[model samples]
Target: MTITTAPAGVSLRGVGRAFGDHVVLRDIDLDIAPGEVVALLGASGCGKSTLLRMVGGLDTATSGTVRVDGHDVTGIDPRCAVVFQEPRLLPWRTLAGNVALGLPRDLPRNQRDSESRQWLGEVELQGFADHRPRQVSGGMAQRTALARALARKPGVLLLDEPFAALDALTRLRMQDLVEDVQRRSGTTVILVTHDVDEALKLADRVVLLGGAPTGVSVVLDVPGDRPRDHHQPELAALRSELLAGLGVPRRTPLERETHAR
Candidate 1:
Protein backbone atom coordinates (compact mmCIF):
# COMPACT_ATOMS: atom_id res chain seq x y z
CA MET A 1 0.00 0.00 0.00
CA THR A 2 2.92 2.32 0.61
CA ILE A 3 4.37 2.88 -2.84
CA THR A 4 7.86 4.31 -3.08
CA THR A 5 7.75 4.64 -6.85
CA ALA A 6 7.76 8.23 -8.03
CA PRO A 7 4.99 9.32 -10.37
CA ALA A 8 5.81 10.74 -13.79
CA GLY A 9 4.50 13.93 -15.38
CA VAL A 10 3.13 14.20 -18.94
CA SER A 11 3.68 16.83 -21.61
CA LEU A 12 2.04 17.12 -25.00
CA ARG A 13 3.15 19.90 -27.27
CA GLY A 14 1.56 20.55 -30.64
CA VAL A 15 0.49 16.90 -30.68
CA GLY A 16 -1.58 15.59 -33.57
CA ARG A 17 -2.82 12.27 -34.89
CA ALA A 18 -4.01 11.49 -38.40
CA PHE A 19 -5.05 8.36 -40.25
CA GLY A 20 -3.73 9.22 -43.68
CA ASP A 21 -5.65 12.35 -44.72
CA HIS A 22 -8.37 12.06 -42.10
CA VAL A 23 -7.12 13.93 -39.07
CA VAL A 24 -8.60 13.08 -35.69
CA LEU A 25 -6.47 15.38 -33.53
CA ARG A 26 -4.15 18.30 -34.16
CA ASP A 27 -2.25 21.06 -32.40
CA ILE A 28 -3.14 19.73 -28.96
CA ASP A 29 -1.11 20.85 -25.98
CA LEU A 30 -1.58 19.87 -22.36
CA ASP A 31 0.53 19.11 -19.28
CA ILE A 32 -0.21 16.77 -16.42
CA ALA A 33 1.78 16.84 -13.20
CA PRO A 34 2.92 13.65 -11.57
CA GLY A 35 0.35 11.96 -9.34
CA GLU A 36 -2.43 14.00 -10.91
CA VAL A 37 -5.71 12.53 -12.11
CA VAL A 38 -7.04 13.92 -15.39
CA ALA A 39 -10.24 12.85 -17.07
CA LEU A 40 -10.85 13.33 -20.79
CA LEU A 41 -14.48 13.97 -21.70
CA GLY A 42 -15.93 14.72 -25.11
CA ALA A 43 -18.67 13.81 -27.52
CA SER A 44 -18.51 10.53 -29.40
CA GLY A 45 -15.75 10.43 -32.03
CA CYS A 46 -13.93 13.45 -30.66
CA GLY A 47 -10.66 11.52 -30.34
CA LYS A 48 -10.72 11.31 -26.57
CA SER A 49 -9.45 7.72 -26.56
CA THR A 50 -7.01 8.51 -29.37
CA LEU A 51 -5.43 11.17 -27.20
CA LEU A 52 -5.25 8.76 -24.29
CA ARG A 53 -3.65 6.12 -26.52
CA MET A 54 -0.94 8.56 -27.53
CA VAL A 55 -0.05 9.02 -23.89
CA GLY A 56 0.28 5.27 -23.36
CA GLY A 57 2.20 4.82 -26.64
CA LEU A 58 -0.58 2.53 -27.86
CA ASP A 59 -0.86 4.94 -30.81
CA THR A 60 1.55 7.41 -32.26
CA ALA A 61 1.01 11.06 -32.98
CA THR A 62 1.25 12.11 -36.60
CA SER A 63 3.08 15.31 -35.72
CA GLY A 64 4.59 17.15 -32.76
CA THR A 65 5.50 15.60 -29.45
CA VAL A 66 4.12 13.15 -26.90
CA ARG A 67 6.25 12.89 -23.82
CA VAL A 68 5.84 11.05 -20.55
CA ASP A 69 8.35 11.81 -17.83
CA GLY A 70 10.28 14.04 -20.27
CA HIS A 71 10.95 11.21 -22.76
CA ASP A 72 9.25 10.90 -26.13
CA VAL A 73 7.04 7.85 -26.50
CA THR A 74 8.22 5.98 -29.63
CA GLY A 75 6.46 2.69 -29.02
CA ILE A 76 4.50 0.84 -26.36
CA ASP A 77 5.72 2.74 -23.33
CA PRO A 78 7.20 0.66 -20.54
CA ARG A 79 6.49 3.49 -18.14
CA CYS A 80 2.78 3.21 -18.75
CA ALA A 81 0.08 0.58 -18.22
CA VAL A 82 -3.49 0.60 -19.53
CA VAL A 83 -6.81 -0.79 -18.28
CA PHE A 84 -9.49 -0.88 -20.92
CA GLN A 85 -13.31 -0.85 -20.98
CA GLU A 86 -13.44 -4.62 -20.74
CA PRO A 87 -11.55 -6.73 -18.20
CA ARG A 88 -9.65 -8.55 -20.98
CA LEU A 89 -8.37 -11.22 -18.62
CA LEU A 90 -6.85 -14.53 -19.64
CA PRO A 91 -9.64 -17.07 -19.15
CA TRP A 92 -7.34 -19.88 -18.14
CA ARG A 93 -5.36 -17.98 -15.52
CA THR A 94 -6.46 -17.62 -11.95
CA LEU A 95 -6.96 -14.03 -10.80
CA ALA A 96 -3.59 -13.96 -9.07
CA GLY A 97 -1.90 -15.60 -12.00
CA ASN A 98 -3.36 -13.07 -14.40
CA VAL A 99 -2.05 -10.28 -12.18
CA ALA A 100 1.33 -11.95 -11.67
CA LEU A 101 1.88 -11.90 -15.42
CA GLY A 102 2.60 -8.17 -15.18
CA LEU A 103 5.17 -8.46 -12.46
CA PRO A 104 8.73 -7.53 -13.32
CA ARG A 105 10.33 -10.65 -14.80
CA ASP A 106 13.43 -10.25 -12.63
CA LEU A 107 11.42 -10.92 -9.52
CA PRO A 108 11.76 -14.43 -8.15
CA ARG A 109 8.73 -16.62 -8.73
CA ASN A 110 7.75 -16.67 -5.06
CA GLN A 111 8.06 -12.92 -4.82
CA ARG A 112 5.97 -12.52 -7.93
CA ASP A 113 3.12 -14.50 -6.46
CA SER A 114 3.37 -12.64 -3.18
CA GLU A 115 3.37 -9.27 -4.94
CA SER A 116 0.41 -10.22 -7.08
CA ARG A 117 -1.59 -11.27 -4.06
CA GLN A 118 -0.69 -8.00 -2.35
CA TRP A 119 -2.04 -6.02 -5.26
CA LEU A 120 -5.20 -8.08 -5.22
CA GLY A 121 -5.56 -7.19 -1.56
CA GLU A 122 -5.03 -3.54 -2.39
CA VAL A 123 -7.95 -3.72 -4.81
CA GLU A 124 -10.03 -5.55 -2.17
CA LEU A 125 -10.01 -8.77 -4.18
CA GLN A 126 -8.04 -10.60 -1.50
CA GLY A 127 -9.83 -13.94 -1.34
CA PHE A 128 -10.87 -13.98 -4.99
CA ALA A 129 -7.33 -14.54 -6.27
CA ASP A 130 -8.10 -18.20 -6.99
CA HIS A 131 -11.22 -17.44 -9.04
CA ARG A 132 -11.21 -17.45 -12.82
CA PRO A 133 -12.54 -14.51 -14.80
CA ARG A 134 -15.86 -16.23 -15.59
CA GLN A 135 -16.42 -17.19 -11.95
CA VAL A 136 -16.46 -13.60 -10.69
CA SER A 137 -18.89 -10.73 -11.16
CA GLY A 138 -18.18 -8.05 -13.73
CA GLY A 139 -17.05 -5.54 -11.14
CA MET A 140 -14.87 -8.13 -9.44
CA ALA A 141 -13.20 -9.03 -12.69
CA GLN A 142 -12.63 -5.35 -13.41
CA ARG A 143 -11.05 -4.96 -9.99
CA THR A 144 -8.70 -7.79 -10.85
CA ALA A 145 -7.78 -5.92 -14.01
CA LEU A 146 -6.99 -2.86 -11.97
CA ALA A 147 -4.85 -4.95 -9.67
CA ARG A 148 -2.94 -6.31 -12.62
CA ALA A 149 -2.23 -2.83 -13.92
CA LEU A 150 -1.15 -1.62 -10.51
CA ALA A 151 1.01 -4.66 -9.96
CA ARG A 152 3.26 -3.38 -12.71
CA LYS A 153 3.99 -0.30 -10.62
CA PRO A 154 3.58 1.92 -13.65
CA GLY A 155 4.48 5.58 -13.56
CA VAL A 156 1.41 6.49 -15.59
CA LEU A 157 -1.80 4.49 -15.59
CA LEU A 158 -4.17 4.85 -18.55
CA LEU A 159 -7.83 3.98 -18.14
CA ASP A 160 -10.07 3.91 -21.20
CA GLU A 161 -13.61 3.90 -19.82
CA PRO A 162 -12.78 1.03 -17.50
CA PHE A 163 -16.01 1.38 -15.57
CA ALA A 164 -18.34 2.21 -18.44
CA ALA A 165 -20.16 -1.11 -18.66
CA LEU A 166 -21.12 -1.48 -15.03
CA ASP A 167 -24.47 -0.70 -13.43
CA ALA A 168 -24.77 2.61 -11.58
CA LEU A 169 -23.96 1.38 -8.07
CA THR A 170 -21.05 -0.75 -9.18
CA ARG A 171 -19.69 2.10 -11.28
CA LEU A 172 -19.70 4.41 -8.26
CA ARG A 173 -17.94 1.81 -6.17
CA MET A 174 -15.31 1.31 -8.86
CA GLN A 175 -14.67 5.03 -9.02
CA ASP A 176 -14.08 5.10 -5.31
CA LEU A 177 -11.73 2.15 -5.55
CA VAL A 178 -9.66 3.89 -8.26
CA GLU A 179 -9.42 7.07 -6.23
CA ASP A 180 -8.23 5.13 -3.21
CA VAL A 181 -5.68 3.13 -5.16
CA GLN A 182 -4.29 6.16 -6.99
CA ARG A 183 -3.97 8.06 -3.76
CA ARG A 184 -2.01 5.26 -2.16
CA SER A 185 0.20 4.42 -5.11
CA GLY A 186 0.91 7.96 -6.31
CA THR A 187 0.41 6.94 -9.93
CA THR A 188 -0.50 9.47 -12.59
CA VAL A 189 -3.82 8.67 -14.22
CA ILE A 190 -5.43 9.66 -17.52
CA LEU A 191 -9.01 8.53 -17.74
CA VAL A 192 -11.10 8.55 -20.92
CA THR A 193 -14.79 8.70 -20.18
CA HIS A 194 -18.18 9.75 -21.56
CA ASP A 195 -19.80 10.42 -18.21
CA VAL A 196 -19.49 14.04 -17.12
CA ASP A 197 -20.34 13.41 -13.48
CA GLU A 198 -17.84 10.56 -13.29
CA ALA A 199 -15.12 12.83 -14.62
CA LEU A 200 -15.98 15.60 -12.19
CA LYS A 201 -16.03 13.26 -9.23
CA LEU A 202 -12.72 11.55 -9.93
CA ALA A 203 -10.34 13.94 -11.67
CA ASP A 204 -8.22 16.79 -10.39
CA ARG A 205 -8.98 18.50 -13.70
CA VAL A 206 -11.46 17.60 -16.39
CA VAL A 207 -10.09 18.11 -19.92
CA LEU A 208 -12.83 18.63 -22.49
CA LEU A 209 -11.77 17.87 -26.06
CA GLY A 210 -13.91 19.04 -28.98
CA GLY A 211 -13.86 20.75 -32.42
CA ALA A 212 -13.74 19.58 -36.04
CA PRO A 213 -10.54 17.61 -35.55
CA THR A 214 -10.82 17.65 -31.79
CA GLY A 215 -8.61 19.96 -29.75
CA VAL A 216 -8.55 21.01 -26.10
CA SER A 217 -11.78 23.00 -26.00
CA VAL A 218 -11.92 23.47 -22.26
CA VAL A 219 -9.79 22.60 -19.25
CA LEU A 220 -11.96 22.93 -16.16
CA ASP A 221 -10.27 22.62 -12.76
CA VAL A 222 -12.53 20.64 -10.51
CA PRO A 223 -12.78 22.06 -7.04
CA GLY A 224 -12.42 20.01 -3.85
CA ASP A 225 -10.39 16.87 -3.31
CA ARG A 226 -10.95 13.31 -4.34
CA PRO A 227 -14.22 11.54 -3.26
CA ARG A 228 -16.19 14.66 -4.07
CA ASP A 229 -19.93 14.97 -4.16
CA HIS A 230 -20.96 15.42 -7.79
CA HIS A 231 -24.16 17.19 -6.82
CA GLN A 232 -22.43 20.00 -4.96
CA PRO A 233 -23.46 23.50 -6.09
CA GLU A 234 -20.15 24.34 -7.80
CA LEU A 235 -19.94 20.93 -9.42
CA ALA A 236 -23.51 21.37 -10.65
CA ALA A 237 -22.58 24.67 -12.25
CA LEU A 238 -19.41 23.22 -13.72
CA ARG A 239 -21.40 20.24 -14.93
CA SER A 240 -23.71 22.52 -16.86
CA GLU A 241 -20.75 24.28 -18.42
CA LEU A 242 -19.15 20.98 -19.39
CA LEU A 243 -22.45 19.69 -20.81
CA ALA A 244 -22.80 22.83 -22.94
CA GLY A 245 -19.23 22.38 -24.17
CA LEU A 246 -20.20 18.89 -25.32
CA GLY A 247 -23.22 20.44 -27.13
CA VAL A 248 -25.73 19.03 -24.65
CA PRO A 249 -26.92 22.16 -22.92
CA ARG A 250 -28.85 21.50 -19.76
CA ARG A 251 -32.58 22.11 -19.92
CA THR A 252 -33.87 25.15 -18.09
CA PRO A 253 -36.58 24.73 -15.44
CA LEU A 254 -39.13 26.11 -17.86
CA GLU A 255 -37.89 23.89 -20.65
CA ARG A 256 -38.01 20.81 -18.42
CA GLU A 257 -41.61 21.53 -17.46
CA THR A 258 -42.53 22.17 -21.08
CA HIS A 259 -40.89 18.93 -22.17
CA ALA A 260 -42.66 17.00 -19.42
CA ARG A 261 -46.04 18.41 -20.60
Candidate 2:
Protein backbone atom coordinates (compact mmCIF):
# COMPACT_ATOMS: atom_id res chain seq x y z
CA MET A 1 0.00 0.00 0.00
CA THR A 2 1.26 3.45 -0.89
CA ILE A 3 1.46 5.95 1.96
CA THR A 4 -0.27 9.25 1.37
CA THR A 5 1.05 12.59 2.61
CA ALA A 6 -1.28 15.09 4.24
CA PRO A 7 0.36 18.46 4.84
CA ALA A 8 -2.04 20.85 6.57
CA GLY A 9 -2.01 24.61 6.89
CA VAL A 10 -2.25 26.26 10.33
CA SER A 11 -4.06 29.42 11.43
CA LEU A 12 -4.19 31.28 14.71
CA ARG A 13 -6.40 34.29 15.36
CA GLY A 14 -6.41 36.57 18.41
CA VAL A 15 -4.82 33.79 20.39
CA GLY A 16 -3.86 34.25 24.03
CA ARG A 17 -2.74 31.89 26.74
CA ALA A 18 -2.43 32.60 30.44
CA PHE A 19 -1.34 30.59 33.43
CA GLY A 20 -3.30 31.76 36.46
CA ASP A 21 -2.11 35.35 37.05
CA HIS A 22 0.49 35.43 34.29
CA VAL A 23 -0.14 35.71 30.57
CA VAL A 24 2.34 34.14 28.21
CA LEU A 25 0.87 34.98 24.78
CA ARG A 26 -1.55 37.69 23.83
CA ASP A 27 -3.51 38.59 20.71
CA ILE A 28 -1.25 36.54 18.46
CA ASP A 29 -2.30 36.02 14.87
CA LEU A 30 -0.40 33.87 12.40
CA ASP A 31 -0.95 31.68 9.36
CA ILE A 32 1.21 28.92 7.96
CA ALA A 33 0.78 27.48 4.49
CA PRO A 34 0.85 23.81 3.76
CA GLY A 35 4.40 22.49 3.18
CA GLU A 36 5.91 25.74 4.45
CA VAL A 37 8.69 25.61 7.02
CA VAL A 38 8.32 28.35 9.66
CA ALA A 39 10.61 28.95 12.59
CA LEU A 40 9.33 30.55 15.78
CA LEU A 41 12.37 32.51 16.87
CA GLY A 42 12.78 34.16 20.27
CA ALA A 43 14.82 34.37 23.44
CA SER A 44 14.12 32.07 26.36
CA GLY A 45 10.81 32.67 28.20
CA CYS A 46 9.37 34.53 25.21
CA GLY A 47 6.40 32.16 24.74
CA LYS A 48 7.50 30.74 21.37
CA SER A 49 7.05 27.21 22.68
CA THR A 50 3.64 28.09 24.10
CA LEU A 51 2.54 29.39 20.72
CA LEU A 52 3.77 26.22 19.03
CA ARG A 53 1.92 24.07 21.53
CA MET A 54 -1.29 25.95 20.75
CA VAL A 55 -0.82 25.20 17.04
CA GLY A 56 -0.31 21.51 17.84
CA GLY A 57 -3.45 21.35 20.07
CA LEU A 58 -1.29 20.28 23.01
CA ASP A 59 -2.25 23.47 24.84
CA THR A 60 -5.48 25.45 24.89
CA ALA A 61 -5.68 29.17 24.40
CA THR A 62 -7.50 31.27 26.94
CA SER A 63 -8.83 33.40 24.09
CA GLY A 64 -9.37 32.98 20.33
CA THR A 65 -9.00 30.06 17.93
CA VAL A 66 -6.46 27.54 16.69
CA ARG A 67 -7.26 25.95 13.35
CA VAL A 68 -5.64 23.18 11.38
CA ASP A 69 -6.60 22.97 7.69
CA GLY A 70 -9.71 25.07 8.45
CA HIS A 71 -10.82 22.85 11.31
CA ASP A 72 -10.56 23.77 14.98
CA VAL A 73 -8.56 21.22 16.93
CA THR A 74 -9.33 20.76 20.64
CA GLY A 75 -6.98 18.10 21.96
CA ILE A 76 -3.98 16.26 20.68
CA ASP A 77 -4.45 16.31 16.90
CA PRO A 78 -3.64 13.13 15.06
CA ARG A 79 -2.56 15.28 12.14
CA CYS A 80 0.34 16.70 14.18
CA ALA A 81 3.52 15.11 15.57
CA VAL A 82 5.94 16.75 18.01
CA VAL A 83 9.66 16.18 18.58
CA PHE A 84 10.84 17.82 21.78
CA GLN A 85 14.33 18.86 22.98
CA GLU A 86 15.01 15.56 24.65
CA PRO A 87 14.83 12.25 22.77
CA ARG A 88 12.45 10.90 25.50
CA LEU A 89 12.69 7.33 24.30
CA LEU A 90 11.71 4.43 26.51
CA PRO A 91 14.91 2.73 27.60
CA TRP A 92 13.56 -0.80 27.37
CA ARG A 93 12.32 -0.47 23.78
CA THR A 94 14.51 -1.02 20.76
CA LEU A 95 14.80 1.84 18.27
CA ALA A 96 12.52 0.06 15.79
CA GLY A 97 10.03 -0.71 18.52
CA ASN A 98 9.87 2.97 19.52
CA VAL A 99 9.31 3.97 15.91
CA ALA A 100 6.61 1.36 15.53
CA LEU A 101 4.76 3.00 18.39
CA GLY A 102 3.93 5.90 16.09
CA LEU A 103 2.23 3.73 13.45
CA PRO A 104 -1.53 3.43 13.28
CA ARG A 105 -3.00 0.69 15.42
CA ASP A 106 -4.93 -0.64 12.43
CA LEU A 107 -1.73 -1.65 10.68
CA PRO A 108 -0.68 -5.27 11.13
CA ARG A 109 2.35 -5.92 13.32
CA ASN A 110 4.42 -7.12 10.34
CA GLN A 111 3.62 -3.98 8.33
CA ARG A 112 4.31 -1.72 11.32
CA ASP A 113 7.70 -3.31 11.77
CA SER A 114 8.47 -2.88 8.09
CA GLU A 115 7.36 0.76 8.10
CA SER A 116 9.30 1.45 11.31
CA ARG A 117 12.47 0.00 9.81
CA GLN A 118 11.93 2.04 6.66
CA TRP A 119 11.66 5.25 8.66
CA LEU A 120 14.75 4.30 10.69
CA GLY A 121 16.61 3.96 7.40
CA GLU A 122 15.31 7.35 6.32
CA VAL A 123 16.89 8.89 9.45
CA GLU A 124 20.07 6.86 8.86
CA LEU A 125 19.49 4.59 11.86
CA GLN A 126 18.57 1.38 10.07
CA GLY A 127 21.55 -0.50 11.47
CA PHE A 128 20.58 0.49 15.01
CA ALA A 129 17.00 -0.71 14.78
CA ASP A 130 17.58 -3.57 17.16
CA HIS A 131 19.62 -1.55 19.61
CA ARG A 132 17.97 -0.34 22.77
CA PRO A 133 17.76 3.43 23.34
CA ARG A 134 20.40 3.19 26.08
CA GLN A 135 22.82 1.61 23.63
CA VAL A 136 22.85 4.49 21.14
CA SER A 137 24.70 7.79 21.20
CA GLY A 138 22.80 11.05 21.89
CA GLY A 139 22.68 12.00 18.19
CA MET A 140 21.60 8.52 17.20
CA ALA A 141 18.88 8.56 19.84
CA GLN A 142 17.57 11.91 18.59
CA ARG A 143 17.62 10.52 15.04
CA THR A 144 15.46 7.65 16.24
CA ALA A 145 13.12 10.17 17.90
CA LEU A 146 12.79 12.05 14.60
CA ALA A 147 12.09 8.80 12.77
CA ARG A 148 9.41 8.00 15.30
CA ALA A 149 7.68 11.30 14.59
CA LEU A 150 7.94 10.91 10.80
CA ALA A 151 6.78 7.30 10.68
CA ARG A 152 3.27 8.45 11.52
CA LYS A 153 3.20 10.65 8.43
CA PRO A 154 1.82 13.62 10.34
CA GLY A 155 0.37 16.50 8.34
CA VAL A 156 2.22 18.95 10.59
CA LEU A 157 5.53 18.42 12.39
CA LEU A 158 6.18 20.49 15.52
CA LEU A 159 9.71 20.77 16.83
CA ASP A 160 10.44 22.40 20.19
CA GLU A 161 14.19 23.00 20.39
CA PRO A 162 14.89 19.48 19.20
CA PHE A 163 18.57 20.19 18.62
CA ALA A 164 19.24 22.36 21.68
CA ALA A 165 20.81 19.47 23.53
CA LEU A 166 23.11 18.25 20.76
CA ASP A 167 26.73 19.20 20.25
CA ALA A 168 27.48 21.78 17.55
CA LEU A 169 28.46 19.24 14.86
CA THR A 170 25.61 16.87 15.65
CA ARG A 171 23.14 19.74 15.68
CA LEU A 172 24.19 20.78 12.20
CA ARG A 173 23.89 17.21 10.97
CA MET A 174 20.42 16.87 12.44
CA GLN A 175 19.39 20.18 10.90
CA ASP A 176 20.55 18.90 7.52
CA LEU A 177 18.68 15.67 8.04
CA VAL A 178 15.47 17.54 8.86
CA GLU A 179 15.81 19.77 5.81
CA ASP A 180 16.31 16.77 3.54
CA VAL A 181 13.34 14.92 5.02
CA GLN A 182 11.00 17.90 4.93
CA ARG A 183 12.00 18.70 1.36
CA ARG A 184 11.25 15.14 0.31
CA SER A 185 7.98 14.89 2.25
CA GLY A 186 6.74 18.49 1.93
CA THR A 187 5.32 18.40 5.44
CA THR A 188 4.37 21.67 7.09
CA VAL A 189 6.79 22.36 9.97
CA ILE A 190 6.80 24.79 12.91
CA LEU A 191 10.15 24.79 14.69
CA VAL A 192 10.48 26.67 18.01
CA THR A 193 14.10 27.61 18.50
CA HIS A 194 16.11 30.25 20.35
CA ASP A 195 19.10 29.89 17.99
CA VAL A 196 18.93 32.74 15.49
CA ASP A 197 21.27 31.10 12.97
CA GLU A 198 19.36 27.84 13.15
CA ALA A 199 16.07 29.64 12.46
CA LEU A 200 17.45 31.58 9.50
CA LYS A 201 19.15 28.51 8.04
CA LEU A 202 16.08 26.26 8.11
CA ALA A 203 12.99 28.38 7.72
CA ASP A 204 11.19 29.83 4.71
CA ARG A 205 9.96 32.51 7.10
CA VAL A 206 11.27 33.35 10.53
CA VAL A 207 8.79 34.80 13.05
CA LEU A 208 10.22 36.50 16.11
CA LEU A 209 8.30 36.26 19.37
CA GLY A 210 9.22 38.69 22.14
CA GLY A 211 8.02 41.39 24.56
CA ALA A 212 5.66 41.25 27.51
CA PRO A 213 2.66 39.03 26.69
CA THR A 214 4.68 37.98 23.68
CA GLY A 215 3.48 38.14 20.09
CA VAL A 216 5.27 38.36 16.76
CA SER A 217 7.79 41.19 16.84
CA VAL A 218 9.17 40.57 13.37
CA VAL A 219 8.39 38.33 10.42
CA LEU A 220 11.17 37.94 7.84
CA ASP A 221 10.96 36.07 4.56
CA VAL A 222 14.08 34.08 3.82
CA PRO A 223 14.24 33.79 0.05
CA GLY A 224 16.88 31.49 -1.33
CA ASP A 225 17.73 28.00 -2.50
CA ARG A 226 18.09 25.01 -0.20
CA PRO A 227 21.18 24.25 1.94
CA ARG A 228 21.75 27.89 2.83
CA ASP A 229 25.27 28.93 3.77
CA HIS A 230 25.66 30.33 7.27
CA HIS A 231 28.63 32.44 6.23
CA GLN A 232 26.70 34.08 3.34
CA PRO A 233 26.56 37.88 3.60
CA GLU A 234 22.76 38.03 3.35
CA LEU A 235 22.30 35.51 6.11
CA ALA A 236 24.87 37.29 8.24
CA ALA A 237 23.02 40.58 7.80
CA LEU A 238 19.71 38.93 8.67
CA ARG A 239 21.35 37.30 11.68
CA SER A 240 22.47 40.67 12.98
CA GLU A 241 18.98 42.07 12.47
CA LEU A 242 17.44 39.14 14.31
CA LEU A 243 19.88 39.48 17.19
CA ALA A 244 19.10 43.17 17.46
CA GLY A 245 15.39 42.44 17.43
CA LEU A 246 15.90 40.06 20.34
CA GLY A 247 17.65 42.83 22.31
CA VAL A 248 21.16 41.50 21.79
CA PRO A 249 23.91 44.12 21.62
CA ARG A 250 26.10 44.09 18.52
CA ARG A 251 29.71 45.07 19.16
CA THR A 252 31.34 47.84 17.09
CA PRO A 253 34.47 47.14 15.00
CA LEU A 254 36.69 48.86 17.57
CA GLU A 255 35.10 46.90 20.41
CA ARG A 256 35.65 43.68 18.49
CA GLU A 257 39.32 44.57 17.93
CA THR A 258 39.73 45.42 21.61
CA HIS A 259 38.10 42.15 22.63
CA ALA A 260 40.37 40.26 20.24
CA ARG A 261 43.37 41.90 21.91
RMSD of 1: 2.5
Cα lDDT, all candidates = 0.91, 0.89
Expressed as tens digits, the lDDT of each residue in 59-119 for candidate 1 is 9999999999999999988889899899999999999999997788899988888898898
lDDT of 2 by residue, 163-257 (tens): 99999999999999999989888899999999988998899999989889898888999868777876666676678788899999575455567
> After superposition, which runs of candidate 2 have C-alpha atoms over 4 Å from their true positions?
1-4, 251-261
Q: State the weakest 10-residue window (summed lDDT) of model 1.
A: 249-258
lDDT of 2 at 79: 91
> What's the C-alpha lDDT at position 31 in model 2?
94
Which pairs of residues have clashing backbones in candidate 1?
A: none
Worst ten in a row by lDDT for model 2: 249-258
Regions more than 4 Å wrong, model 1:
251-261
Each candidate's number of clashing pairs is: 0, 0
